[model samples]
Target: MGAAEWMQARSPEQSLTARIVRWYSFLSATLVGG
Candidate 1:
């Protein structure tokens, strides 16, 4: 399954954790790539 489908299968706690990690990754990329 694709990412959206995969994420939908996760529990709410897992979803929240994934969201936090996604934000962290975005920030890190911006900081390092800027």
Candidate 2:
């Protein structure tokens, strides 16, 4: 399956982890960009 399909198949914990990672990356990028 493709990355999008794989992401859709992920479990709840994996989704939560993904959200945390996204937030962490966003925050890190904002800090560094500023």
Candidate 3:
């Protein structure tokens, strides 16, 4: 149960990190292209 709760809490953080990474990559590509 504790492990499940920890995993649930971690999943959002991982998702947010992935989103931030994707956004950063997009911005970098746009800047480089322009």
Candidate 4:
């Protein structure tokens, strides 16, 4: 899927709190891995 469509699809799958937690964890892992 395209970036815009993927983001649109994901937005409603989780609450704001859940999304934030997921994004934070992803960023942390990326930084650590890099």
| Model 1 C-alpha lDDT per residue in residues 1-34, reported as the tens digit of each score | 4764466477456786786787689889999999
Which residue pairs show backbone clashes in model 4? Answer: none
lDDT of 3 by residue, 12-31 (tens): 66766666676688889999
Model 2 weakest 10-residue run by lDDT: 1-10
Q: After superposition, how far is residue 17 of candidate 4 from its true place, in Å?
A: 0.4
lDDT of each: 0.73, 0.70, 0.68, 0.69
Local distance difference test, candidate 4: 0.69
TM-scores of all candidate predictions against the true structure:
0.53, 0.54, 0.54, 0.58
Off by over 4 Å in 1: 1-13
- Per-residue lDDT over 1-34 for candidate 2, one digit per residue giving the tens place of the 0 to 100 score: 3644455477555776786776688889999999
Model 4 per-residue lDDT tens digits across residues 1-34: 4644554467766656566777688889999999
Instruction: Give candidate 2 regions above 4 Å deviation.
Output: 1-13
User: Which residues of candidate 3, in runs, are more than 4 Å off?
Assistant: 1-13
- How well does candidate 2 match the true structure in TM-score terms? 0.54
Q: Arrange candidates by lDDT, descending.
A: 1, 2, 4, 3
- The candidate, 2 or 4, that scores higher on TM-score is 4
lDDT of 3: 0.68
| RMSD after CA superposition, every candidate | 3.9, 5.0, 9.6, 3.3
